[model samples]
Target: MQLIIMRHGEAGRHSLDHERELTEVGRKQAANVAEKIAQSDSKPSVIWCSPYIRARQTAAIVGDILGVPVKEKSFITPDDDPGRCLDALLENKESPLMLVSHMPLVGSLTTLLSDGHRNGMPFMTAQAVVLDMPVVGPDCATLKTQFLP
Candidate 1:
């Protein structure tokens, strides 16, 4: 299975964190990343995105460009457990899955999947990493490369 992990674009500060929308620069960043994905040969079969506004917006752009459906998964939220997210993804049979999510979760999940440790990687906003995994488990995946927008 191929997994694509992406951190949502830059977002503006707001009293309600979950409702905070992406800024102009964020939108551009999302568009740039989407364009890059559209041109890539490894297109996602489906996209799983956090319900957060910024992530949802980012997923929308990518979904449009790739012509793939996006599903909102609460498990991908910033504060959610990476293990649980992995379990959920493992249940799915789709290959080349894309996940558009937030900071700590994105970084944590990447490390957990690629290196079997948390905090082994740092993910910037709008950054993406691809992993090739034979099975869903800690350290079972190989880092294929990364995309930055």
Candidate 2:
């Protein structure tokens, strides 16, 4: 299976963390990444996104460009456990899955899957890392490439 782990675009600060919205620059960043993905062979069958506004917005852009369905996964939230998120992803049968989420979770998930360790990667806003995995487990995936916008 191929997994694309993406961090949400830059967001404006809000009193409610979940309510923070993407900035104009963030939208442009998402658009740039979406265009890049659309030109690639790695189209996602399904997209999973955090419920947070910024992540959802980013996922929407990708899903629209890729013509894939997007679903909100609570486990992909910023502070959620990477192990649990991995387990949830493993439950899906879809290949070429995409996940739009926040930092720490995005970076940690990539590290947990690629290097068998958490916090091994630090992702910038609007960055994505692709992983090819035969099965879901620690260190089971190889990094294909990273896309940054």
Candidate 3:
């Protein structure tokens, strides 16, 4: 299974954290990323987003381009654990999972996925982190990638 960790694009600097929508540039960034993903062989089976407006908008833009549906998942909230969020995705049957969320957590999740991530994980705006998970047991799994996007 592949996990696509996506960060919401540039948001309004003056807007509240919970309500900020993507800036014009952010919208373009989202579209470009979406188009790039649509051209990929590893298409996302599910697109999950944080309930935050910016994240939701970003997810919707990508979802539309990829013809994949988008939904707000609470587990991906800013306060939620990135590891648990990733775990929830692994439990899902979706092969290529896309998650749109904020920072700190994206970096945190990337660390959890990469174990040590000694090289550091900094996902640029609208950047992607493609992750591969190998099945360890019927209900268990392990990440096996150091690739970036």
2-64 per-residue lDDT for model 2 (tens digits): 999999998999659999999999998988898888888778899999999999999998899
Candidate 3: Cα lDDT at 5: 81
Candidate 2 Cα outliers beyond 4 Å, as residue runs: none
Query: Ten consecutive residues with minimal summed lDDT in candidate 1?
Result: 34-43
Give the better candidate number (1 or 3) by TM-score: 1
Clashing pairs in 3: none
Q: In model 1, which runs have C-alpha deviations exceeding 4 angstroms?
A: none
Using lDDT, rank the candidates from best to worst.
2, 1, 3
Which rank order by TM-score, best down to worst? 2, 1, 3
C-alpha root-mean-square deviation, candidate 1 = 1.0
Clashes of each: 0, 0, 0
Identify the superior model by lDDT, candidate 1 or candidate 3.
1
Instruction: Note the Cα lDDT for every prediction shown.
Output: 0.89, 0.90, 0.76
lDDT score for residue 139 of model 3: 24
Model 3: per-residue Cα lDDT at residue 41: 69
What are the RMSDs of all candidates, in order? 1.0, 0.8, 3.7
What is candidate 3's lDDT per residue for 1-149, written digit by digit as tens? 77788898888978678898899999999898888777766578889999999999999898988999897898886667766776686568877888899887777776666664423357788887777767512223244332222
